[model samples]
Target: MLDHVQIADAIAESLITNGVRTGTRLPTQKELGESYGAPRHSIRKALDLLEKRGVLGARQGSGTYVLGQLVDYQISSRTSYNHNVRRLDASPTIEFLELRTRQATPEIARGLGINRSARIFDLYVLRRSNGEPLCLARHYLSEDRFPTLSEHLEVATGISDLLRRIGMQDVRRSNSSISARMPAKHEAALLEIPQASPVLVLEGRNVDAKGVPVEISTSVWPASRIKVHV
Candidate 1:
């Protein structure tokens, strides 16, 4: 006799074999119970476990839905999301989540080579591929270098394009650091993965021709879907 946990694993396997994908609703508790020869309560428990593992999600007043695997992302000093998406023949889009002016923290100052408490422009962006969320990025730009940055840049404009348009040509990535950890509650919600899912973090700096740091970026991607290439 299979336990609720075992039943849940079996259901997950069934989902893949049946071609069920992200956003595909699973059968109702009663139906699952009947199919698996288990009690309704056990079926619910199975679903709950799956949800905690980020394999499924239960929406209010809606049925539980399958949560698909994370999208793969490649990280490198020369990483260009636009180019990568084009190479993969996937539609890529960027969504601006927030923009604000704030004083830089010591860490941000170090990354951008600015003084602590210096004014900076913060831009939060969500990058998607084929309508699926992929990564969340936070950008810090030195206000002194591009005072009118917020007014000139749009959500659709790539960072490289923005630099060229603003007369900051020849900008290149100066440094990047990578790390990994489980996602936080809010981050998990934004990425539509379970809270226990791991995320890859990349911290990078971009410099102009003079080698002066102009921008600092920190992005988090789903670890399950992305691999860091050097």
Candidate 2:
């Protein structure tokens, strides 16, 4: 007889093999036990294990559901979010939330190699894959360098495209650091995940062909939705 751990492994594998979509409600405990030919207690244990692994989630008074497969996102010299999603045959979209000029903080100044209190363009955007929110990004760019950035960004396709239009032909990530933590209330709501769920924070600096800092970006991603490849 299979133990609870074995049953959990089997069910997880089945979910992958069957390509179960995220948010798809799973079978009841009774039905799962019958299908797995396991005892009810064993089925319950297996479901608990899966939930802990982030492969499944339970809704209050509802039922368990598949959490979906993790999307592979690469952090490389030339990282493009749209390209990454497209490589997986998924559609990607970026929605601009806010754009304005603001004084650079000490941290932002250091990231952009600019003086603190200098004017900078602050842009906030939400990234989505297949119509599901994937990440929220905050971008900082020197206002002096791109005075008309706001006008271009309002109609631009993405950051890369906007950069190209502003005469920055080559844009690349100079450095990136990743960390994990529980999401804030607004972040959880935006990502459509539970507040208890963790999120991956990616801090990245991008440069032009001349190696001059162009943009400082901070992105938050749902831990269950993406696997970062460094």
Candidate 3:
């Protein structure tokens, strides 16, 4: 089943069932090979074809994972990141930095499926593992859906946490794109990295349990330290 097509389909189905949306990361090719009894090279070919079909992606050191946002009732895996980190001898903290209203930019609007000038709810979150910055997230919400967005500031930091808080019980990501690029001067300063350092950029849009686009988020990670698992 590790051939070009079979393994790819297997991964796709597995992801779909697990609620691993697009732009989510998958297991490493080596892990896939081990799991499926294929050579790494063959596993890589399967991944290559999946990526071509917009179903898989590799994020530098983060290993291979899903490629785009989440799809339908594909219930995401019931994994608790906070618990996992604590089990790994670390703590998790979600800092409720702040939220505001802003007009979406041309790029933001396009991803959010809105007019380029639509106003949206903007959120800033700092996710720390063991009290060290692990992921910095900026989320954009279709304000029309959650007019009371600002009132939900004290919720957890993880994306799933926020989704649950909004009563979006079945929210799932349908597409996401993860890329790495040199950090901007400001981002570099904030992440405590050199300007030349590259940061991992993740773009994700999630649909509600009803499959309506309700949230879009772009997260930045300092490439040197983060281990991204989609």
Candidate 4:
């Protein structure tokens, strides 16, 4: 016997096992229903569940399809644009506009999981997705962890890969705190959106497989362009 959610999980499993890329047209609802021994409504319910997870898409006249592009994610557990985009072989370029060593103020300390006055790497970046401006981000990393961040500025493209080179394999295990608000003037300018556009702000630390904070990231994105798939 199988529950509906399990059935949906099976569909997800099948999609992965079959190499279904994003944008693959899914089986029609009738086809799915017949194959699963379920009714169309039940099949639709499963598909809807997948849609909300940023895994599927619906079109007005074209039925349902696979959502190929990875969504900006915020599960209660973890999320990162770097890990998200890799599902499609896309990579984010980090402009690395600034990287400085600074004394951690109270706010910075809390954000970086460090004691007050500790030295930290303050990093500013522009994150681009497929060559379009996606976010403006700031990162704070305690100097004890990322030792040479201050002396170098070579990271004009991609942080996750760079981290892997530095021996951090799992960039997705990071703790994330997220919120949404209307864009501030500065944020609007940086992100190139209208002042009225809502922006989602994400702040968190990228934890290594050992659960250490490897990268601290803050990101902002216009509401109209993103869907939270958690």
Candidate 5:
């Protein structure tokens, strides 16, 4: 009897050999088990392992489907999600989840160089490629510095666009730190990944031409879907 690892390897090879198209759903666990001469439990474990490896994705109440190629995302002085996705011939869109003013925490205060508990504009957005959720980003901006930020966001395309509209022409990345960990429940649901799947966390601060911190952001990406290039 083949173990789960070996079963997963076999299934992956079958997918490639059969030229299974991306987004094509696989057979049910029982069907796969019968075809592979393995038990249903072993088939389930193999599916799970394949999902974690980014070769497949499981949809709730649906079935497992083949995933697309990994996206190459570059980190540089000026990193734009839209630009990056477009460079790979993919359509990119941003969904603004929230825009609110809130008191800054100790970490936020330090990142933005503001007083603790200072009011800041909390901007939350979900970015997608070809309608597939790819990243969740949260941006903190000092409200006092840009009192009309909310107004601009209402009509602007994105953070960078709004900043330019408000007369910030020269904005660049000042610093960045990358880390990895398993996704949280909410994060997993939002990014449409299994809770057991790992995610890449990017924390960074953007500065203006004057070298003053303008935006402190935290972005989360599904590790399986994204390949970060520093």
Candidate 6:
């Protein structure tokens, strides 16, 4: 007569006590049910709940596997995704979702200190750690400063490298703002998390050596996969 919640809690406890590392595949639903003295339906429900909590991932046709631990993200004036992930002893990667030039909106213009009608290079990037999607970001840069930036930059190199390649080696973070909210449908899909899951929003501007605003970006991180430290 064990409830699914109780079964899930017991499984979690067993995982901890048995030193179940990340990527360790759990037993089959039937096996788990037999071990816990519960039905297969209850065991499946328990695994589904664990998957929602980011504790496990259930692959189609494959069994559920542990998802290991969350990454500790340190917020600071000098923020670097690569550096941050490396500090956690993990590999970092970036994927470009968008890259194009368009007329700046009022908000984008204000953030980059450009005219509303000015052309801006808009880049949407997805960042990952240890092959897991961590966040999605949209960055805006004034096209006038780096006329050929669109041709030179690649998602793999990131914005910092792009600035350096364009002779803006001394760029630094000018300001930042942080907030929290549930993810949008598209964003949740990209992050591979539930739509009801919360995300940490970070908005910031970077300035060149002369303190001229050079770039502005907004990034959204899955709340469950990151521990933000100020």
lDDT of 1 by residue, 42-133 (tens): 89999988877677889999999877543334556566777765555667778888989999999988888888978999998888767778
Residue 143, candidate 3: C-alpha displacement in angstroms: 1.2
Give the CA lDDT, 0 to 100, for residue 228 in model 5.
73
Error of 4 at 228 (Å): 1.4
Candidate 6 residues lying further than 4 Å off, grouped into runs, are 1-50, 57-69
Candidate 1 stretches with Cα past 4 Å from truth are 1-72
* Per-residue lDDT value at 165 in model 6: 82
Candidate 1 TM-score, C-alpha based: 0.70
TM-scores of all models?
0.70, 0.79, 0.59, 0.60, 0.76, 0.74
The CA lDDT of each predicted structure is 0.78, 0.85, 0.67, 0.68, 0.85, 0.81
* lDDT by residue (tens digit), candidate 3, 24-85: 55676778889888898888888887665445567787877654432222112333446545
Q: Which has the better lDDT: candidate 1, or candidate 4?
A: 1
Candidate 2 TM-score versus the reference:
0.79
Per-residue lDDT of candidate 6, residues 91-153 (tens digit): 888888889999999999988888888999999999887788888999999899889777765
Question: How many clashes in each structure?
Answer: 1, 0, 20, 1, 0, 0
lDDT of 4 by residue, 1-230 (tens): 45567667778767755545556788898998888888877888888777654467799998888763324444544555666656546666667777788898887777556789689877788876566566788877788877865444574246655666556666664556779998778877776666765677877667766666676777887654455555
Model 1 residue 89 lDDT score: 60
| Lowest summed lDDT window (length 10), candidate 6 | 13-22
Which candidate, 1 or 3, has the higher TM-score? Answer: 1
Candidate 1 weakest ten by summed lDDT: 68-77
lDDT of 6: 0.81
lDDT of 3 at 38: 88
* Residue lDDT tens for model 2, 59-138: 98999998744467888999999898787677888899998888999999999989997999999999887788889999
Which regions of candidate 2 fall more than 4 Å away from where they truly are?
Answer: 1-69
